[model samples]
Target: MSHSSPASSASAAPASIACTSLDYVWPDGTTVFDGLQVSFGPGRSGLVGVNGSGKSTLLKLIAGELRPSGGTVRVTGEIGYLPQNVTLDTALRVEDVLGIAGTRAALHAIEAGDVREEHFAAVGDDWDVEERATAALAGLGLGHVGLDRTTGELSGGESVLLRLAALLMRRPDILLLDEPTNNLDLYARRRLYAAVEAWNGVMVVVSHDRELLERVDQIADLRGGEVAWYGGGFSAYEEALAVEQEAAERMVRVAESDLRKQKRELSDAHVKLARRKRYGQKMWDNKREPKVVMGERKRQAQVSAGKHRIMHEEKLAEARERLDKAAEAVRDDDEIRVDLPHTAVPPGRSVLTLRELRLRHGARVDGEFELRGPERIALVGRNGAGKTTLLRTLAGELDAVSGTADVHVPLRFLPQRLDLLDDELTVVGNVARFAPEATPNEIRARLARFLFRGARAGQRAGTLSGGERFRATLAALMLAEPAPQLLLLDEPTNNLDLASVRQLTTALESYEGALIVASHDLRFLESVGVTRWLRLDGGLRDTTAEEVRAEMAGEG
Candidate 1:
C-alpha cells in the first residue's frame, strides 16, 4: 500500500550527512556533547546509547529543532524529522496534521469552479496530494481513517502513525526518526518496521527496539560523547562490542600489573639511593682517601643516584597513564540491586480479583482472575483498550464503571507518565515519603543500590535525567512501606534506553511478588518471564507470545 517517493531511487553516489566540531550546552549548565564529530552516508543507521547520553539532543541538532553552541550539520538533500513525542492539536483535522490542508482546499475550490489565481498557486504541482495522503495513511494500516477526521478521534498509536505519514509525504532524502515506536502497539510497530525496511533514503533512527534495530544497515553507538561505528545490525554490533570490551578488560589488567610493578621498582630505587647516601656519608666521615678524591667520588655518586631516581619516576608516570587510558575503554553502567524478601506472597494466596469489570471509557472487560505466589502477567492490547484504566482502577486511582476490582495484597501501579513522583522533592525525600519509618541512613543505603549515592540522592527529582528518574521512581515503589506484594507497571520501557531497560529488568528480578505489566514490547515481555498473557479488547482472553507475534505478522 506504500506510495513510491522520489527519494527512494538508488543512485551512483550516496547522500552526505556530517556534523563537525559539534558543541552543545544546556541552559542549566549541563554539557551533553563537546567537539563531537560524526558523519552518516545514505543507508539505515541505528543510533543507540544509554539513557541521557544525548541521542535525542543530537537528533534535534541535525533536524534544526535545536541549534548547537558551535558546529555545522551538513545534509546534501531535504530532511524530514520525526521527534520522540509528537503532540498535535486535538481539534486539527487529519489533513491539517498531514500538512496538505491548503492543497486539498485549493483542489476542492477548483472542483467547485471557483478557481482563483491563489488557489491554483496553492495547488501548484501536487494535484494528487489527497491520493498520496490517503495512500500514506493506508500504508501504515490506518486505511479506515479519513482526512476530515480530527486527531482526537485517533488513538495515541494512530496519531504517531499519522505524524509519520506526514513525514513520508514530504519524500525527504534524509529521514530522522527519534524513538518512533515508543508507544506503538504490536500492529503499528510491524507497520513502522515494514516502512523502515522499504526506505531507500538515508535514515537515522534513535531507538532501543531490537526488532527495529535489526533492520538497520549499521549501528552508531553513542558513548562518552563519541560515536563507534559497527557494521550490520544490532546483533552484529553487540558481538563487536563484546570483543572490544574483552580486549579493554585485558588491557586494564595488564596496566594494573605494570603499575604495581613500577611502583615497587620506584620504592626499591629510593631505598637503594638512601642506603648509598648513608654509606657515602660514612666513608666521607672516615676520610679513607684525600679530600679532593673524596669530593670527586661524592659528586659522581650524587649524579648517579639522581639519574636512577629520575628513571624510576618516569616509568611510574607512564604506567599511571597506561592505566588511565585502559580504564577509559570500559563502561560502568549502573544496575539496581534489591532484595525484596518481605514482598513475597505465599503460593496459595489470592492477590487480585476482577468481577465484571467495566472502565469509565465504555470498554466492557469482564473477567475473573486470581494470582498466586509471584505470577507475572503481561497485558497486551491496542492503544485505548483500557489497559491503563484497569491498572489505575486496581491501584484505587479511579473508580470502575460497574464491577469491582479488589486487591487482596498491597499493590503499586507505575503509570507510563511517571507522575507519581513529587517533582519538588529530592530522590531520598520521595522514597522517605513512601517509607516514613525508614531512617535517613537506611534510605541512603537503599538509594545507593538504585545508583543514587550521597549528593545525587539529595538532588531534586525534577533535575534527574529520564533514566535516573525511572530508577528513582522504581526505588520509591520497591522501598515503600508494607512492601508492595503486587506490582503493576504500564509501558515501563517506553522512554528507557536499552541499558535502563536492563537495569529495570534486574530490579524486577529481585522483586518477590505478583506482577502485572502492560507493555507493547514483545521482547521485554518475554524477557521478564511472564507466566500469563492477557489481551484486552472487549474482554480479557488468555493469549501467548507466539500468538501475538503471529497476529502481528498476519496484519503486517
Candidate 2:
C-alpha cells in the first residue's frame, strides 16, 4: 500500500539495547510491562501494536524517559529520542533546537580572533558543526529555514522534523522516533523516509504510518506485554499475522470439538456407572450370590467407577485448558461498525459547492466548484495551507471572507480538535445529545459497535483515552440526527493508532455519503476509498493519487 521504497538502513555493528526481565507499573498499580524481555540491534525496526498496548511506554523506557518498576535497561551508548508530543520554547532559535548553538557560538568566537582556552575546548572537533547542521536540516527539507529563525515560526510538521534534525545531528548510537510522521506533509515525510533509510545505527520507530512501517528492516510487534519479531516490513508482518491467526482459529475450533467430545464421554460414563449401581442393588436384593460376594463386587465396581470418572474429568479439564490457550492466541482487535443508510445520497444529487470562495485564513478557491454525487475527496496540502479553514467554511463554522459556500445536503464536520463532545456527559449521553430522537437503548446498541460496550458506554467523556475520545467524538458525529450526507473531516487520522485508523475506515466504509477528508496520511486516504484528490496550496487544484505519489517520489 506504500509508494515509498523500503528503507535499506546501512548495515553496521552498532551497540545493542537489552531489557532483561523488565517490569513497569504505574503509581495507580496498573501494570504495563512485567518481566518483559526484548532487544534491538542495529537496523530500522517498526514497533507496532494496538493503542495503549504500551508501544510508547516501551520507547520511553528505552530512552530513559521512564524507569522500570523492578528491572534494569542496559544500553551501550547515547540514545536520541523524538517523543510523540514535542513541546519546545517558541523563543528558541533553530540552531538551539538542533543542539548546535553553543558549538556554533564557539566556532564564531575562534574565527573572530577571540579564542580562549574555554572557547577552544568548546569548539573541539566541531569546527564544521554549523555546516553539518545546515546540511542535516537541508536533508530533512529544512534547508530554507535559517538557523536564527524562531521555533514559533515553523508549522507543526516543521517543528517535528526540526526536532528530528537535531537528533540526527547528535549521531547517537541508538535513535527512537515516536509517531514521526504524525503531522508531516508529503515532502517532509519523504525526507524523513530518506533519513530513516540512511540511518546506520540502532533505530526503532513507533508509528501507525504504513509507509513508514514499510521502510523498516523488521517489525517488533509489542502486545500483551511481550514482543514478537517479524522479518521484513509492514506488508510481510501482516501476511504472517494472517497465517498465524488462521492457525490459531483452527486450533480453537479443534479444541472446542475435543472439549465437547470429552464432556459427552464423561456423561456416558456416568450413565453406565448408574446402571451398574442399579444392577448391583438388584442382585443384592434378589440374593443371586452370597452377601459377602455381592458386597465385594459392589465395592470393586464403585472403585472402578470413581477412577473412570476421575480420568474423564481430567481429560475434560485438559481440553478446556487447550481451548483457553487457543483462544488467547487469537487477537481481539476491536473495530468500529456503523449502518448509516439514511446518509446515502443519490448519484445525481448535488452535494457541496464553492463559488469564488475566500476563507478568513487567506486560502482562496478560484472560480466555482461543485461536488456531485457521493464523491470521496482527499484534501491534501502542506501545513498552514488552510485545509482546516476550508473544512470550517464547509461546515458553516466560519463565514467566508468573500464569495459564497453552500451545502446542499445535511452535513457534519469533524475538526482536528475533537472538541465536539461535552466532558460532563457519558459516552451514551453524548450520542443522545446528537440524536435526541434515538432511544437510550438504541444509542447504547450503536455505541457497542464503536467498542464502547456495556459499562464502557457509561464512562464519562472526560475519562476516555486519546483513542477512546476520538471514537466517542466520531460516534456522536456520524450517528447524529438527520444523518450527515456530506462529511468534512480535517486530518482524521492524526494521532490515531493503526487499529483506530482502520476503525475509522470501517466506519467510513458503512457511510454512504459524500466525504471531504483533509489528511497527510497517504495509506489512510487510499483505505477510505478517496475518489478525488484536491491539493490546496495557494489554490485548490485537482490532482491524482499517482501524481501525489510522483510528487513525493519526484521531490525525493
Candidate 3:
C-alpha cells in the first residue's frame, strides 16, 4: 500500500519502441501478427487482448527474446522484461537473484582488505548497490527478506515481488512485464500496483489484473491482428470501446437499410426496363416507326438498361462492404455456455462436510461446516495459507493428517495445473474419455459449446494455447461421467487472460452444482456469485468480499 520512490526515471532520452511492418507466423502456419505496425513511446501502456492473441509474444519480440519473421523492431534504450512465469532457483541466495551477488562479494572483499585489482573493478561505481537493492526489495514489500536468505524460503507471492525488485534495480528505460501478478496474492498485487504507478519510464505491461491496468497511462488493445490505441487507463478504455461499439452497431443498421433500398431500386429498374421493351415491341408491331429507327431505339434502350444495372449493382456492393466493415468494428466475444441440470443438488442434500480436518501443513480446520444445495463458496487466503492443500485433501488427491472430508455426491476437482485432460488426446477425445458412454458425435457437439468447433475439437491438447487448454480441461471435468455435483477449483484464473476469465465465469453460471473456488482474484470470485466467503488461515472463517478487499487495502 506504500512505497518509497525509486531513483529518478532513466536519464537517457525517452525510449521509443516500435514494430514496423511486423510479421510472425508459427511453424504450424498460424499467423499472429501480419504487417502489424505499432509504436509505443515513453509512458505506462497496458497491452491487453484475448488469450492466444499474442500479447505475450509481442512483449517477447520487443524484449528481444523472440524475433519477428519479417520486419524490424526498434528499441532505443536498455530493456528489462519480467515474463509471465517467474521461476527462481531455490538454491540461489536473494542477492544472487537480484543480480548483485558479484558486486556484494567485491564490496565484502574490499572491506576485508583482499587488495585485488579485479575486486576494485567489479565494485566500481556501485558502492551503494547493497543499499539500493535493499530499498528496491522494501519498496516491493519484501523489507523483511534478507539478501542472504535462499529463494526456496520465500512464498509464491514473495518470489514474484523479488523478481520484480530485480528488474527495478536495473532502472531500465524500457520495462516489459507480462502478467506479473499471476502468482501474487492480494497484498502482493497491491504492492505491484503501487510499483506500476510509480514507474516513470517507458513501461509496457501485459496483464489481466484490472487493478494494475487502472494505473496505466494508455491502453494498447491487440485484437484481430492489429492494435487499437485508447488514451487512458482500463476504465477509460472500456468506456471508449463501448462508445465505438455503439457507433459501429448503428452504422451496421444504416448500411443494412441502404443495401435493402438498393436492392429495391434495382428490382424497380428491371421492371421499368421490361415495360419499356414491351412497349417498344408493341410500337414495332403497330409499325409506329421505321424498322431501322425502331432497331436503333432498341439498342439505345439496351445500353441505358446496361448502365442502370451496373450502377445499381455497384451501389449494392458498396453497401455490403460498408456493412461488413461496420460489423468487423463491433466485437463478438462469444462466451462458453453449459447446462448441467443433472448436477444440481437439493437444498436438503449435503454436498461437502469437513470435520476437524487437519492438513499436512499443520493448519487445523477445526470447524464443522456443511455445504448444501448449490452454494458457491470462495476460498480466500494469503499464499501458503493451506488453500491448495485443503482443496487437494477434499478432492481425495491427498490424505489429510487427521479428521475426515465427506463428499456425499460425485465430485470433480479442477486443479490449478489442469492435468485432468490427457495432453496427447484431442479435445473431443479427452471429453469422451471422461464420458465413455457418450457417443463420439455427442462429445464433439458438446465440445462445440466450449468453443472447440469442427477441426478445433480434433486438435491435440498438447498443441493448444494456455487458454484453449484450460477450456478443454474444464469441458472434460464438467462432462465427466456421473456428473460432478460438487466442484472444487483451485486458482482457476491464475494463468487465464481476461477474456478466458470471463468465459470461465460464464460457464460456471450454468453450473447448478455446489462449488468451492480457491482464488486470489476478488473480482472473479464476486463475478461467480459466491454465496459464502471462507478464508483459510490455519482455520476456516466466514468472510465477505468487502472485508477481504479492506484487508488488502490495509484498512482491516
Candidate 4:
C-alpha cells in the first residue's frame, strides 16, 4: 500500500490528531511514555488498559495539557477535554458556568474581527448560547436542574454529568474524555453512549466501562509503555490478547526446553573433557619414562592434541552455560500470573431480614419496607436517593435511628471507597493483616488466585489502582475459608474495568450467599442476576427492577 505524505495526510484526514515519538518523564525519574506514536481520525475509539498504564497521560498529551519531552503532537482542529474529575468553580451557577465558556468564544471572535455571522450562528443565534446549553443539559439528564443552581450543590455524579453537558455544548472537532461514565448512573451512562454514537466528530474515550468500550470501533490497549491498536471492540481485543499470551507462554516453554537440552549437553561435554584429560595425563606420565621415551614421542603428540581439543570443548561448554542463563532470565520475565482464589460461602436460611424498615434522616424519609433473603438484591436509585445510606445501615455501619433490622449470618462488606483495606501495606501484607492465620505461602497462593502474583503481590496497597486494590481486598476475603454468608457491597463496579467487572460478576453469580448491593450500573445488576430491587428515598421501598428502570427512563 502506498503511504500519503505528512502534509497531504494532515490535510485529508478528518478531525485527525497525531503524536509522533512522544516521550514524557516525571520529576521523580519515572518514564511514563517512551517513543509513543498514535493517531486518530473520525471514528469511535476506546483507550483500554490496566490502571496507570498511561491511558490518561496519553489523553493529556493529545489534549495539549502536557507537552511531550520529545517528538511532536499535532491536532488539526479544536479539541475538547473531559477530565476524570471536573471541579467546577462552586461560586458559579450552572448558567454562568456555560456563559463563561461562551464569553471566551465571543472574545476570541471579537479580537479576530474576522468572525463571520456563521461563527456565532454555529454556537447559537442571538440567544443561541442559552438554547445550546439547555439542549446539552437536557441530553445529559440535567435539564430538570435549574440553570441558577450552584455547582457546589451538585453531587459528584451530577457534577460529572454537567461537565459532560458543557463538553457536548462546545462540540469540538475531536472529543477527549477520561472516565466519562465513572460517576454516571445507568440512565445517564446509556444517554451518554447514545449521544456519542450520534456525534459527528472523532471521539477518544478513556474508560473502564466495558459496555462503553464495546461500542467503540477500535481499542488502543496501553500495555508496558506501548500502545497496541486492535481493529475491533473489547471482545476482539480480548481474543487477540489471549492469543498473544498463549504465544508468549509457548515461547517460554520452548526456551526452557532448549536451556535444559543445552545444560545436559554441557554436562556430557564436561564429563568427556575430564575423561580425556585423565587419559592424556596417564599417557604423559607413562611416556615420560626414559627407555620408551623415543617411541612414546608420537603418543605424547597425540595426547597433546587431545588436551587442546578438550580445552576448546571446555570453552564451548562455558559459553553454553552463559546462553542458558540468558534464556532462563527471558523465560522468568515473560509475564506475571494472576491467580485468584475462590472463597465460596454457604447462605443461611435467613441471612438478612428487614421488617418495616424505614430509613430517615431528620425530616427525609426513605421507605417503609420489609425483606427476607438468601437472595441477591440490588439497591438502586437516583444520585441522592439514599441507596448507600440504606446499605450502610443494613451492614450495621450506620446507626438506624428507627426500624427493626435482623441479621442471621456473618457478613463481609466491600465499600465503594475500599475502607476495608489498609493503604500503607503491600498487597501480600494487607491480605496477611486481614487474614493473619493464613501462612505466607497460603497468602501468596490466594493472592495469585486474584491475579496478584510475583512482584505485584509485593506492591504497596496505596500504589495499586482502584481495580487492583479491589481485587486484593477480594482475595483477602476469600482467605476467610468459611466466607461471609452475607455480602453488602456499595457501588462495587465503580472503578473496575470491563474485564474485571465481568470476572467479578461471574464469581458472584455462582455465589450461594446473600447479597445486598447499591449501584447504578444496570448492566452489572442484570448480569449478577439481582432477584429483587429495593428502591431508596427517605426510606426503603420494595420495588421491581422494571419499576426502577422506568423511573430512570422518565427522569431522562
- Which is the leading candidate under TM-score? 3
The Cα local distance difference test for each model comes to: 0.86, 0.85, 0.85, 0.71
Error of 2 at 239 (Å): 2.9
lDDT tens readout by residue for model 4, 295-321: 476577567757766666675676566
* Superior candidate under TM-score, 1 versus 2: 1
lDDT value, residue 265 of candidate 4:
64
Kindly report which residue pairs in candidate 2 clash with one another: none
Angstrom error of the Cα, residue 448, model 4: value is 9.6
Give RMSD to native, each candidate. 4.7, 5.7, 4.7, 7.7
lDDT per residue for candidate 2 within 1-556, as digits (tens), equals 0111112342233467888888987654668888888999889999998776788888888887887887767776678999976778999999999888888888888889996999989888888888898899899988989999999777678889999999988888889999898778888888999899999989999988888889999999998999999999999999999999999999999999999999999999999999988998899999999888988998999899999999999999999999999999999987666555467789989988889998865799999999999899999888768887788888888899999998999898888767888988889999999999999998888888888898789878875655677788888986787878898887778667777777678778878889999888887889889989999988999999988877777642
For residue 13, model 3's alpha carbon misses the true position, in angstroms, by: 4.2
Native-vs-model 1 lDDT? 0.86
Q: Tell me which of candidates 2 and 4 scores higher on TM-score.
A: 2
lDDT per residue as tens, model 1, 1-556: 1111224333334666788888888765678888899998889999999877898888888887877888777666677998876778999999998999999999999999997899999999999999999999999988889999999877667888999999998887889998899778888888999999999999999998989999999999998899989999999999999999999999999999999999999999999999999999999999999999999999999999999999999999999999999999988876566555467888888998788888876666665666678899999988767787788888999998798788998888888767778989999999998889999999999899877897778878876766677778888887787878999998889778887777678667777789999999987888888999999887888898888888767742
Residue range with the least summed lDDT across 10 consecutive positions in model 2: 1-10
State the lDDT of candidate 3 residue by residue for 1-556, as single tens digits: 1111222453445677878888988765778888889998989999998877888888878887777888878777788899876778899999998999999999999999897999999999999999999999988879989999999877667788898899899888888998888767787788888888888989999988888889999999999889999998999999999999999999999999998999999889889989998998899899988899999998998999899889988998998998898888888986566554467788878888889988886666786878889999999887667787888898989999889889999998988767787888888888988888989888888888878888889888876766777788888877788888898998888667777787778778878889999888888999999999999887999999999989888786
Structural similarity to truth (TM-score) of each candidate: 0.89, 0.86, 0.90, 0.68
